[model samples]
Target: MCGIVGLYLKKPELEDQLGQLFSPMLIGMSERGPDSAGIALYGDPVADGRLKLTLQHPDMDYDWDGVKKALETQSGAAVSVDACDNHRTFDVQGDEETLSQWAEANLPGVTIMSLGQRIVILKEMGTPQEIVDRFDLTNVKGGHAVGHTRMATESAVTTAGSHPFSTGQDLCLVHNGSLSNHNRLREVIERRSSIRFQTENDTEVAAGYLTWKLREGMDLDSALEAALEDLDGFYTFAIGTADGFAALRDPIACKPAVLAETDDWVAMASEFRSLAHLPGVENAKVWEPEPAKIYTWGRAA
Candidate 1:
C-alpha cells in the first residue's frame, strides 16, 4: 500500500498559499508511508540562493564530507549533507538540472526527485517531521505540489523506492494500485524508446508509457485515454509538471479518489480525511468523482 495526495490550483490571490496548503496536506499523510516520503512542488524561477540536496546511503561509509566538499566546488557554495541515516537533505542555488545531473553522476543510485522554486524533496525511511526538519518546509512556497509517504509492498524499502517517480519530461507521477499489464508494457516501451528502466517497481512503467507517448507526440488527455485502453488493472495517479497538473483513476476504479474543487484549486486523495488539512477548506464543498471517468483539473490560471 502507498499514499498519494496532490493539489492543482488556479492563479491564487495570495502568493504563499501553496506552501501553507501543501505542507499541511503532506504532514497529514506521513503515517501512510513511513518507509519513504517526498514532495514535488512546482513554481516559477526564484532568485539564486542555497539549494537543499538530500541524500541516502545504505551504510555508514557514505563519505558525505568528501562528497559535500566536491559538490560545493561544483555548486560554488557551501555544501553539507544532513543526518547520515538512510536519508539526508541538501541546499543548492544554481540550476536544478545542473545540480541534479551532477548528483546523478556522482551520487550513484541517487535520485533528484524534485527541484521546485522554493522546495526540494528530503524524504527517506522515516517519519514526516523528521524529513521536514531536515529541509525546513515550513517556509518554502510554491504554486502547486504533490507529496507521498510510501509503504513499500513489493519493492525493497530503499530511497529510490519512494513516491513521485520522475517521468523525465517535466512530468512526475505518483500512483496508488497495481498495473496487471505492466510487464508486457514495459517490455514494449523500453524496446521502442531505448530509455533505461531504473527499478523493478511497476509504478515507473506508467510514467514510462506516458513519457514515451508524449515523446511520440501524444497530448496528456489522449495519453490518459490511451493508457485506459492499453493498461490493465487498477490505479489512481497524480501527474505534475511546470505547465499543468492532473490526476486520474483507472476505468475500473478499483482505487479511490475524493476531490474538492473551487474556482481557485482542486485537491484530491484516496480518502476524505486527506482533505481535512487544506487552509480555508474546512467548509469547502468536497465530493467524490465518478468511476470510469477521466477528470482533468489543471491550473485554471
Candidate 2:
C-alpha cells in the first residue's frame, strides 16, 4: 500500500498555508509508505526565482556535487550544496529557462521530467524532517504541490524508487496498487521506442509508458485514457503537473483515493483521515472516484 496526497488552492492565503500544512499532512500519512517520501510544489505564476534540488547517499553526495556544477556552469545560476547525515542538499536561483536547460543538459540517467516556474519538486527516502533537513526543503517556496511517503513493494528502497515520478516537463505521478501487466507493457514499450527503462520497478515503467505516448504529442488526457485501456491491473494513481493534477483508479476503482474539495483548495489521500483538515470535512461527503473515472485539479488562474 502507498499514500498519495495533493492540494490545489484558489485562495492565495490558503495557498500560503500549503507548505506549512503539507509536511504535517504528509507526516500523517507516513504509515502508508515508509521507504521514501516526496513533495512537488507549484507556486503561483510570477514568483521569485528558486529551484531547489536535494540528494542523499550513504557515503557520498553525488546528487549535490554533480547537479550543482551542472546548474551553475550550464545555466549561469548560483547553486550551493549542503550536507545532512545521509543526503546532500542544494538550492538554485534562476528562471525556468536556466533550471530546465541545466537539468536537461546535465541530469542524464535520471528523469528531469518536470521543470517550470510554476513547479518545485522535493523528495527523499525517509521521514519528512529527514527530507527537510537534508534538502533544506522548507526554504524552497511555491504556491501549491505534492509530497509522498513511499513503500517499496516490488522495487529496492532508494531515491530511484520514490514517488511523484515526473513524466512530462511539468507532470509527476504517484501511484498505489500493482499493474498486473507491467512485464508485457514494458516489453512492448522497449521494443518500439526511443525511451529508456532505468529501473526494474513498475512505477518507472508506468512513467515511461506515459512519457512515450506524450512524446508522440498526445495530450495527458488522451495518453492517460489510453494507458487505462492498454494497461491492465489493480491500481490507483495521482499525477501532478504544471497545468493541473489528475487521479484515477482502475476499471473497478479498486484502490482507494478519497478527496476533499473547497472553492479555495482540493486535497485527497488514500483515506478520509488523510484529508480531515478541511473545515467541514466530516465523515460525510468524502468519497472515492468512480471506477475508470479520472479526477483532475489544475492551475487556479
Candidate 3:
C-alpha cells in the first residue's frame, strides 16, 4: 500500500504558501508509507523556449557547478543550476532530448528526476517527514503539487523505485495499488514510443502509459478516460502536469481515494487524514472520487 496526495491552488494569492500548506498533508501519510516519498511541484514556468531539469546524485556535495560548466560547454546552452540538498534544477535553453542524452552518456552518477517548463520533482528513499525536511519542502512555492509516500511491495526500496514517476515533460504520476498487466503494458509502450522504463516499478509503467496517451494528442481528461479502458489495474492515480492536476480511480475502485475542494483550492489523498489539516477543509466539498471518473482542475483543463 502507498499514499498519494495532491493540492491545486485556485487563488493566485496563495501561491507563496503552497509548500507551507502542503508539507503537513504529505507528512500525515508517513504512517501509511514509511519506505520512500516523492513530490512533484508545478511552479513558475521558464521561458517558452527553455526547460528545467531536476537531477539527483547520491552525493550531496557533488559539484553541481562543475557539471553545469560541462553541460554549458557541451551543449552551448545558457544553463543555470540551482542546488538544494542532493538535487539540482538545471534551467537550460536547449533541446530536451539532446540534454537528456548528454547527461545519460556523460554525467556518470546523475539521474534526471524530471524535465519540464514548470515542474520540479524531488524524491528519495526515506520517510515522508525525512524527505520533506531534507528538501526544505516548506519553502517550495508552486501553483499545484502531487506527492507520494511509497510502501514498496512491487519493487525494491530504492530511490529509483519511488513514486511520482515522470515519463513525459511537465507530467508526473503517483499511484496507490498495483498494476497486474504492467509488464505487458511496459513492453507495448516501449515499442510504440521512445519512452524507456527506468526501474521494475509498476507505477512507472502507469506513468509511461499516460505519457503515451498524451503524446497521441489526448488532453489530460481524455487520456484518463482512455486509461479506464486500456490499463488493467486496481489503482488510484494523482497526475500533475505543467498547469493541471488530475485524479483517477480504476473501474472497480478498489484503491481508496478522497477529494476535497474549497473555494480557494482542491486536494486529494489516498485517505482523508492527509486532508484534515488543510485550511478551510471543514467547509470544503468532500467526497470519494467515483469509480473510473476523471477529476481535473487547472488552466490546462
Whose TM-score is greatest here? 3
Q: Estimate, for each residue in 98-120, the C-alpha lDDT of model 3 and write its tens digit.
A: 87888888888788899889889
Write down the RMSD of all candidates, one decimal each: 4.4, 4.2, 1.2
TM-score of each: 0.77, 0.79, 0.97
Q: In candidate 2, how many Å is residue 156 off? A: 1.2
lDDT (10s digit) by residue, model 1, range 81-184: 44534455555566655776788788875555555443444456666566566546666566777777677776787667677776654567888887788889
Which candidate, 2 or 3, has the higher TM-score? 3
Where is model 1 more than 4 Å wrong at Cα?
A: 46-109, 114-122, 299-301
Report the error of model 3 at residue 8, Å.
0.5
TM-score of candidate 2 relative to the true fold: 0.79
Write the candidate numbers in order of decreasing TM-score.
3, 2, 1
Model 2: per-residue lDDT, tens digit, 87-138? 4445567654555455556565444434544555555678656765665555
Model 3's number of clashes is: 0
Question: Order of all candidates by lDDT, from best down to worst?
Answer: 3, 1, 2
